[model samples]
Target: MTKKSRRTHSPAFKAKVALAAVKGDKTLAELAQLFDVHPNQITLWKNQLLEGAAGVFG
Candidate 1:
């Protein structure tokens, strides 16, 4: 069997997923399925967004 290549997501896409995660309208699993990304990745993006938000205003 052949190995699958790693996928890279654009910043826009990551921001979209991160925003959805922050909205808390759906579970991580639901968001993962809807966005076709791993739950951990969503969490990472969410944290990154929160962390960087402070810098945006500063």
Candidate 2:
């Protein structure tokens, strides 16, 4: 059996998905399916966005 190819997503895409997660309009599972990524990844990006949001104020 062949291994599935790994995919790389752009920062803009990650930010968009993470922003959607922050919006609270969809569940992690839903976002995962919609973005074709793992739920944990979505959570990670969301946390990153939150952690870095303070930079915008500086």
Candidate 3:
């Protein structure tokens, strides 16, 4: 059996996923499956995106 390797996601990819999460177009589980990442990771990125969005205006 082969071991699963750790994957490193780029900022753009994370942003895309986070944006999708923000859009509410798909459920967290769906996003996780689509992005090949954990639901929690997507949520974290989504929250980070939201938290930092204010910086753009500030």
Candidate 4:
């Protein structure tokens, strides 16, 4: 069986995913399905967003 290659999402796409996580309207699974990515990726982006939020005011 051929292995499926991992796809690279663009920065804009990642930003969109991060924005959706910030909005918190949908669950991680929903975001993952909608964006065609893994839930862990969404969680990672969400965490990154939260971590970087503190720098915006500095």
Best by TM-score: 1
Candidate 2 regions off by >4 Å?
Answer: none
lDDT of 3 at 56: 100
Question: What is the lDDT, from 0 to 100, of the residue 47 in candidate 3?
Answer: 98
lDDT of 1 at 35: 93
Per-model lDDT: 0.98, 0.97, 0.96, 0.89
Q: Write the per-residue lDDT of candidate 1 for residues 1-40, one digit (tens) a residue.
A: 9999999999999999999999999999999999999999
Tell how far residue 12 is off in model 4, in angstroms: 1.2
In Å, residue 2's CA in model 3 sits off its true spot by: 6.2
lDDT of 1 at 11: 98
As a whole number from 0 to 100, the lDDT of residue 3 in candidate 3 is 100
Question: Candidate 1: lDDT of 33?
Answer: 99
Candidate 2 lDDT over 1-58, as tens digits, reads 9999989999999999999999999999999999899999999999999999999999
lDDT for residue 57 in candidate 3, whole number 0-100? 100
TM-score of 4: 0.83
- Candidate 3, 1-58: lDDT as tens digits: 9999999999999999999999998999999999898999999999999999999999
lDDT tens per residue, model 4, 4-45 = 998998878888899998899999989889988899999898
